[model samples]
Target: MKPITRYLGVFVCTALSACASGAPLSSGKPFDLTPPKTMMADGIFYSQRAWPGTVPMQVAIVEIDLQTRGLSFAVSSGRASDASEYRSQTTSTFLRESGAIVAINGGYFSPVVSAEGLGQDAVGFAKSNGRVVSPASTPQTAGAAKAVVCFDRRQVQILAALACPDRFANGLAAGPLLVQDGAIKVDPKNATRHPRSILGINASGNRLWLVTIDGRQKGYSEGASFAESALILQALGAAHAINLDGGGSTALVYRDPVQGPRVLNRPIQGGVPGTERPVATHIGVFTKAKPKT
Candidate 1:
């Protein structure tokens, strides 16, 4: 029988106890092996795999062509609880409503005590097209107000959380920075295991990596830690990467040729399989289009 894919949106209470015991699969080298299946269109790359890992990991990579595809942050429904109070939406809903070809859940939010089934409060530092979508949600807490990913007109950058200014043209703050200049930075000693969401940029900065590791579901996928997730992104060729809001907030959306747009991985939700947690922000990918002149 196929592995079960449903998961309740809850944080994995305990660490793997062994996630830090072994080296990353593939020796932390770029995975040169061709994907079992591949699809490329509109400059977007897609691959499917049950990645080789200590856990039964499921993954779908959406590599958007930054040079061709339009990448931008979309506030959930582009609406807040009170239109600036608390914004939120489903990944699928964000995709369909924003007309995004694909989308990955954005950075962290408030009232989010842990990674799963946590309450979705206000947003962290999130900027779109040079506008602050939400102000700093917290008062410079540790790992707070940091913009792990920054994209300017020239190139993308992986900066420290505090490095991000109050606002920028485009950027989001979420992470333990994974790779910088092609080197993995996550501490190998990290042993926690939970679902993961990563956003990365390749050597050329043209290809963006949107990676999701399904976890919290037994027999299907166990999940990945900061170090393990770093290894995964590095192997996939991310010159610079950031761990996004992971755990139950980990979600990926893609339009299936046959099934149309849908969340690909089984997100942990209320201890249920295939349930989704509403999120505060989403970085969306749309078909190639000329910038409005």
Candidate 2:
């Protein structure tokens, strides 16, 4: 795909800086849910918040309007002939190579430590541009991989893996479905916290949200549990959401017209800050060029 010629200035904000103001978290916690410092474009908003709780957390978010005329989605495609065979690349690389305005790491996969993320297989079902890149996993293999989000043009829907249709324009499976029907669905007993990547949509499914929470670094951003993640999405008004591949693989990248592509969150791979792990799949978002004024 050709890269977008029209460039937009992108800004990265820290917890201390003031940005635009939005609705506070519905939980009523002291979360500093400020609006984005700047709008990336029409229908795209970027923002960050500092949650000074028992464990401090930093979050990055990109909300896109599905109704945007030129909005489209792409999943990383591998060169392997075998659907199971997969290669990994950093989220930023996916963004640049795909010419997407926004990119985020996708579904869980077998870990591959190489810089290229080679010799890896997607842990669950994955499809790219109507091709089944990876098949669905049995519950025995990945219980969390039971939920899937399907995309067809500007329309999106979350479905159980078993309920997924035989055909879809694009889709990926990753879960422990975080939210459904405006309710949190993660196991309450599960309290494990790590850096997380989440995809969510409003009840109307016309708005899409991509979120990343930085974690594992003490005194900075400690991370969030499954419940906490769900709550954050709920606060942002997501009626349905799913957890994507996270931890060291948690990465979000944005294309700045001038700076090219850049990582939005501080990704920690192998305990090193700013390190990006190669992952099996990524979701890239593209927007059509704006009309000349």
Candidate 3:
């Protein structure tokens, strides 16, 4: 119970780019998702479009509770935007006002654009748009990131880990709330699942489950990660898990509890910057502080 290093100065000086141990077995590259045209206000849910400029930039995911308290794990870049707004600032201004460059500590690390940011505290992988991507910039023999064992918020809620794809680079899949009776269907070439995914999702009470992890490697953080998709969401019963953003920075923008907030994921192209910024340190927003009648 002693591993607390909370440095939320945001992007400390951006430089990183050192990861890579192994994993990569795909000879059919080509994934698709256009995502654009969005709206959801009054507490907001985001998506004005732009996301890394198109072609599924790098990754994205957002699942805020209602406003802010404990369940708001977001992830962006790959032309980022997971809209469910409740702003203040920090998390590197949602990854540099929507162009991507947070580069370490949020979910699947990578975004070190630094004209003078990130400063120090190094990890690895930066330089988006021109391309560099991560999971530690792979190619060692393939297969490294893999530790899926969730439900550890002190050990029964969900803590999640799945990062060793050579020590971590991208293939995130944060947790809590996925209720289709929970879910578990592993085996993405299993070697433990290399940072592959499946996170816990309880959202402080029982939000169900609907998490995913299958980045499919393209340049970096190569193959078999997501740790059997976070042990298949802790064998389908997530308590509380972590790890957001995945290759092309995995995207998941769902807000349809009956149009309760109104914007439901499908971002890509259009002035961008609704909000997004990978390579994080700490950002878990949840809101519901208005009850006392």
Best by lDDT: 2
TM-score list, all predictions:
0.77, 0.87, 0.25
Superposed Cα deviation of residue 215, candidate 2 (Å): 0.3
Q: What's model 1's lDDT at 171?
A: 69
- For model 2, what is the alpha-carbon lDDT of residue 149? 83
Tens digits of per-residue lDDT for model 2, 1-293: 12112222334333335633333442445455564444665677777677645677888888888888888887877665754457778888888888988899998888667578466888778888877878788778866788998877788888767335766678888887999999889876777889999999999989889999999999988889998888888877899999998999999888877777767788999899888998889988888953111
RMSD of each: 8.4, 5.0, 19.7
Clashes of 3: 82
lDDT of each: 0.64, 0.79, 0.28
**Winner of 1 and 2 under TM-score:** 2
Show where candidate 3 strays beyond 4 Å. Answer: 1-92, 95-180, 192-199, 202-205, 208-224, 239-244, 247-284, 288-293
What ranges in model 1 sit over 4 Å off? Answer: 1-32, 69-77, 80-85, 112-120, 137-139, 142-145, 152-155, 163-168, 256-260, 289-293
Q: What CA RMSD would candidate 1 show?
A: 8.4
Give per-residue lDDT, candidate 2, residue 99.
91
Better of 1 and 3 by TM-score: 1
lDDT of 1 by residue, 1-293 (tens): 11222111111122223222222473443343354323334556555566665557787676666776344433343433343434457677777777776788878776643233333554466666666666554545635335457656435666766435544456677877888888887787877888888988888877778899888888988888788788778777788888888777788886544444567677885566676667777777655442111
What root-mean-square deviation over C-alphas does model 2 reach? 5.0
